[model samples]
Target: MMMRPPLVEVRGMTKRFGALTALDDVSLRLAPGAFHAILGENGAGKSTLVKCMMGYHRADAGRLLVDGQEHQVAGPRGAHHLGFGMVYQHFTLVPSMTVAENLILGRDDLPAVVAWAAERERMEAFLRRMPFRVDLDRAAGALAAGEKQKIEILKQLFLGRRVLILDEPTSVLTPDEADQILGVLRTMAREGQVTVVLITHKFREVEAFAHEVTVLRAGRRIGGGHVKDLTRGDLVAMMIPPMLAVEALTVLDDKALTAVRELSLAVGAGEILGVAGVSGNGQRELVETLAGQRSPEAGLIRVAGERYRPTRRQMRRRRVFVLPEEPLSNACVRTMTIAENLAFRNFDEPPIAVTGGFLSRRALHDRGRELIDRFKIRAAGPDASLDTLSGGNVQRTVLARELSQSPKVLVAQNPCAGLDVAATAEIRGRIMAARNAGAAVLFLSEDLDELMELADRIVVMFEGRLVYETARAAADPHVIGHSMASHL
Candidate 1:
């Protein structure tokens, strides 16, 4: 059988950011009316590739073809005109507006005078044709994450986009919600209504919905083929490369409730083991137990095959460090100066301590200055108050302090939760750097995307127990999500 020409194709596409090559000689063919997935690790240039296709970023070198004809897209608007639209990882709907209002808000041809009645009538027809249902009259903000996402996709379709590019569309959704949305899109693709290109790192979604796959690694097209021709192992082998181990660990919350029950996992040398779950699902308690804020009722904690404790002496001796959540509240003293806070881990034992057991202010400030510069922390100086810094800067301070000693084991909880794009990338880079330097990292986060991006393996924690585990290569987001919600 002859193959249908690609609806969208890129040849030798290359994009560079001064020193870093974001996409390197990457070529992909997105088949018409097919569910195609672009899979890769966080920095594998998945988003960059799609953005280049949409003209969000102009490629330094490459050729873009639509229906076998070469064309240079002027911008996103140009791509939209050519039947291409993208749904970002974050929702774009306006909270205060009704779904109907949001659906028509982005059009270029809106009349100066309002025409709600006719627009509503047209939207009703559009919604009726869609596979999913979302109340048009309801406020967009009042809808759940899944519904909001559906609206985002619907908005594109309503705008008459025939080729849809979804960037991590289901990251915030439940397993069932994700399945429902993907299933509907799969149906749309099968029925020849739309060509779907999914940018994701989840194996389960690819196996279940995608017809063909293109895998990118470190900005290059490393591997790809029909979904049927590849296994989880094959995919994992393409993504690339553990230390902390928790065995039969049990811990209680402040109320004396068993918040953590029989949790067992491991992180090898130079590996990140991501713990995923909804908030209040013993994630906090587990981190607390590991950090020594809470004592475990039972279980063994080891470092490099030796039993370990969270005592200051033991942590220092074992070279273990922690970056707890909410650094300002849980990890730092707000009233203290940046220098003082940075000295907390080693004030008494370091060069910061003088001959008579007194802290040398100069040494402390000097060390603080070094760390501040190294971590790129934005601050007045080492003497500046900790509270005066921004959330991202405070996180930087804590990360700088913990990583200073080049720890043998690191426990981090939502290190980039509220940080901006640049800060998040910097912090994640530091964490990955530590892993590369041979630290056993136990990374805990409620963000599944964060886990999928950084972890070598992931295990879901639910109701105080780890119910599911998978290697990054073999992970099934559906299974992990079900385990997180205790649906399995």
Candidate 2:
């Protein structure tokens, strides 16, 4: 194959935030028409690298070469001029606006915020030209994880981007949704529609979607090569230094843990089943599938001894609720008022009639007030926009609604992921309370210390499969650590 000219080149890129050095002379070359995957653990340099490219952060030392010519991306606007576009894991869109308005949001050509005849017509024209498909009038806040991501991608395409950077784009999507995204990328690559680079910890995605892969560890570029030539083990080893095993959080009697070995375990009605694994395991799949977002191709799901599976209708049932890891993306509607987002989770409700079936606005307001006071949600009021609250507060608001329904099965995926030490403890306590109340809790988390403290039985998931289960007492960090790594 002939070498295509590089689209962007970073040489000796070095950056630091205050006393912490985020990038240690990391360098990467993204070639034209090639899909590149940047792989690393959380807090690694993956996000830092992308931010530097977008001019969100300035590099203390480095040279950026675009089309073989040096360029300084002073800010987001400057990056746009360079034909660079981005779709973040957390989308920024107006929830009340129609999809078409969001697709071309912030364009100066529009006189008013409302979708006019010509603008809507043009948006329709543009939508037909692109691979994105879905209803245009639907509120951005009402869309699912996958559908919302599509709007973000469409935003970039409508801006006439030649290169698109997607950050953890599939983190909240279902397996089928993820496959659809992969197909769209494949089509774009085949037709040379755009140059794409995605940042993720999921190695399988690298193999499925990227032509080349770059591994980073502790702010340094460790390796780069064709994705096909690398195994998941190879990538994991490169991303994290070799070590014997992670220490166990606690100890348990081996013989007493035998009851945990069931291939398929069942928690009685109102019982919360917890599964604790490191971040990026199958938690996303676990919650999403259980919430009816994923349709399992192999295994079976049964509720009350009847085969239960994911469907649009199932999701609307509200039987199972998920408090996703990505709070801003999944838990709350960023731009919508708290009242409006609360309604989105009411899957049990029928569609609004022509006259519009109502959620008693006053009743909802009082209920929101109660939840805010109960959960200590930091929001202005029921009318307050959810975007104004911090991540933890937003998560608490989402939790209020989920726990309100008193779901039969509640899957809280990484409930404490980005919280402070105290906040983590607080959220974990709430989860335990749910379990004590007889709710089946699938507490999927990476915090082993947490699992040791909360879950009666802890399970480890490796590469899309559950590898082992042990009593909380036997939850040695090393065993779980080994299970988390190449042992799978």
Give candidate 2's TM-score.
Answer: 0.48
Q: For model 1, which pairs clash? A: 242-267, 242-268, 242-269, 242-271, 243-267, 243-268
Clashes of 1: 6
Relative to the true structure, candidate 1 reaches a TM of 0.51
Runs of candidate 1 with Cα error greater than 4 angstroms are 1-242
Worst 10 residues of 1 by lDDT: 1-10
Q: Which candidate tops lDDT?
A: 1
Q: Total backbone clashes of model 2?
A: 17
- Tell me the TM-score of each prediction against the true structure: 0.51, 0.48
Candidate 2 global CA lDDT score: 0.72
Q: Provide the lowest-lDDT 10-residue window in model 2.
A: 243-252
State how far residue 488 of model 1 sits from its true place (Å): 1.0
Residues 1-488 of candidate 2 have per-residue lDDT tens digits of 11222478889998999999999999889878878899999877999998898889999999888888999889888877777888888878899988877877755354655547877787778778778787988999999888888888888777777778889988779989988986797678656777888899987788888999999888989897998898886786687643111111111122322111112444444444456556554556556656665444345555433455546456445366678778788666789888667766652354311135554666556666777888778778878988888877877777777777666666787788777776666677777777777666667777677677777667776545567777676678788778867445
